[model samples]
Target: MTDSWLPTLLTETSEEGYALAVRLSRTAVKLTQPSAEVRERVRADYAEDFGALIAISHVVATNFHTVAAANGFWRS
Candidate 1:
């Protein structure tokens, strides 16, 4: 099952969420290996970046809103 936040963000046309999803999905696909051992090692490398992505998404969303507001898009 997907997280509740995912649909809400997606429906709101959240570019940050979409960008994060794309990055994570690409990482996941790149890590696919025939050996479970190699897969675990790959996941270990990606786990840290995964955490960073969460933080970065929040920053990106905040910036997005700020830019939108500056353009008077939020006044509507």
Candidate 2:
């Protein structure tokens, strides 16, 4: 995980954060596409990448909530 997006995610509006999270999720999927070598190296490398990708998904969901709240779209 790079520090690059951390500040933007923290400071930008929820909409921006949601966009960024979606982009990150796509990128992470591309990275983890299973090649033979990649499968062999999962313990050494791909596991962390996969974990981070899951974390990004969580962030995306959180941002969705934020956007909904900002727009007064929340349910009781």
Candidate 3:
């Protein structure tokens, strides 16, 4: 991932915010693992693990919290 990724976290809608959160989560994993082959090797382990799924959900939620705050909680 050589693209420049700077999160403004200033989304206009809650749906967009959620999508950003998911992207944030995926990006983190990509950066940490860095190797597609390694990530694919362990994919099944996390894919079938309930705890791992919940952990990822928590990460996305945490990222969303920041995104929401930056957007003023999407207030009108």
Best by lDDT: 3
Off by over 4 Å in 1: 1-48
Q: Residue 11 deviation, candidate 2, in Å?
A: 18
Cα shift from native, residue 48, model 2 (Å): 7.4
Runs with alpha carbons beyond 4 Å of true place in candidate 3: 1-3
In terms of TM-score, which candidate is strongest?
3
Candidate 3 Cα RMSD (Å): 2.7
1 or 3, greater by lDDT: 3
lDDT (tens digit, per residue) of candidate 2 on 1-76:
7666334334245456566557655545556774656546654564568786687668667666655565455232
Give residue 3's error in model 2 in angstroms: 24
Give every collision pair in model 2. none
The Cα RMSD of model 2 versus the native structure comes to 9.1
lDDT of each: 0.53, 0.57, 0.89
Name the candidate, 2 or 3, with the larger TM-score value: 3
TM-score to true structure, per model: 0.34, 0.35, 0.89
Q: Which stretches of candidate 2 lie over 4 Å from their true place?
A: 1-48, 74-76
What tens digits encode model 1's per-residue C-alpha lDDT throughout 1-76? 8664223322233455445455545444455555777767767675779776786566556655554554455345
For candidate 1, the lDDT comes to 0.53
**Over all chains combined, what TM-score does candidate 2 have?**
0.35
